[model samples]
Target: MFRLLVMRGFALLLLAAPAAGAVEEALPNESAAHLSTLGRKPDWSELDKYQATITHDEFVQLFRQIYATRGCNPDLIKVELDVARILTAAETQNYFVLHFAKGEADRRPVPRWWAVPGALPNEARTAGPLAGFHIALDPGHLGGTWAQMEERWFRIGDAPPVEEGNMTLQVARLLKPRLQSLGAKVSLVREKAEPVTPYRPSDFEEIARQLLLRTGVKDARENFDGPADPEKEQTIAWQRELLFYRNSEIRRRASVINHRLQPDLVLCLHFNAEPWGDPHHP
Candidate 1:
């Protein structure tokens, strides 16, 4: 069961979503190109480590089942007998080729920063069953004063509000020491009820306006300080806040886990909260 989790973690890292941020380096002559929402231009060199580590069939299965469920796009990606050609920059028509192994015998070991339990040295394993396992616990959202803004909170009549972020953090805190006792190194993406990103909603205002205008919103307002209006909810102000909390915060957390901590497994803890017809009764 533990080994399975580590493998799943490896797969998750491979299919990780495009992160939020400005492009680290601009493509020549296409510096002004519009990227995905808060998305950076991907570094194709990152795929180098995965070369020849996966079989052709395995690549197809992961792509069809996990990466792109709607089916492959020939324009964006093309699969051949032993290599997958992925378009890195559409404007430049640049492609990144990934070579696949012929079969299990032909496969190269996947190069990863983290080590599995069985791969660890004997001394490392002597600590405990979970020794050498690096686990990252990401308690979902930013709780506290920001919970209501992120919409992770709700209240019943006389009862205290149920905040999903706070609850997840509580669970992570309780689970941390228990996992440590098992000799696994545990790290928390969010150790408190605050945000992980240094950026705030105001910092995203310009980007939000640009997005709104590009999406054909004729009059994207400059600044917004009014009450929440359902009819006017798609304004720049609302969009900026959404980008800050959802995109920037998540990207920062991912950066910490991927680059700094390099955990073997990342457990994102969350709880579902469905609407109750009557808060008082439910």
Candidate 2:
């Protein structure tokens, strides 16, 4: 569900108005003073001091308080229910988890009070403007064998074909160094044509079936009078692959971003296409 929300939120991010600028900038001395007052790190030990469990609503309230105190924008953050752990009857409770792109908002005009404690060694802090920032680049789509099926590949006449997945990857590769030169740490969600998630069609056959049914790619009552046609069979297979790529594959990428990389900011790169009235004109 968190994966679904993240995927859906990308559209909102693209459509949102440019963030309003910070009300005021913190001077270096003021930044240092703020850091001193806020302390050097969050107290994780406090977690052990709290009750073992809390209602989902309680967690949301707590998270809101924490976010407000830290001046985070609630509108930009997403909170979702996590129910992966429920081994016992008493443990069958749902909990809420917050997900957001750290440092991606102009709302945080003031610099963070303390640097991520272990993010940098003492010497590297002098690297450049983005010295301590971490950015994750997610070049969208599985381009290799799935480009055409994903509807991200197009060719008109003798001109070179356009592949959105491949293009985004190239962009990410090129942008990495430019950001790095400014001292930001960078990671790519996928460095190659393959998906980051290990899931395959066989692993979620039921999901594929449902997706095909919902999309009208397959029908319960429609059947050929004779034996199955090879071409139709092939089309069905491709449709399943499309469903897996769109749903499962993307969710896996979200998992990698939220759990494994956990970078301060995430960028999903892609290209848009429009109808070509004349193949050669544009």
TM-score of each: 0.82, 0.51
Query: Compared with the true structure, what per-residue lDDT tens digits does model 1 show for residues 1-282?
Result: 322232233336544423323322221222134344565555567668778989889988877776666564476677999898776665677878999998999899876676766688888767877898989999999888988778787777778888888999999999999999989999999999999888788888777777777778868765555444653455877888888889778867877776677788899999874346685687
Specify the highest-lDDT model's number. Answer: 1
Ten residues in a row with the worst lDDT in model 2?
Answer: 30-39
- Cα lDDT of candidate 2 equals 0.52
* Number of clashes recorded per candidate: 0, 0
RMSD of each: 6.4, 15.6
Q: Model 1, which residues run further than 4 Å from truth? A: 1-34, 121-126, 221-228, 273-275, 280-282
Each model's lDDT comes to 0.73, 0.52
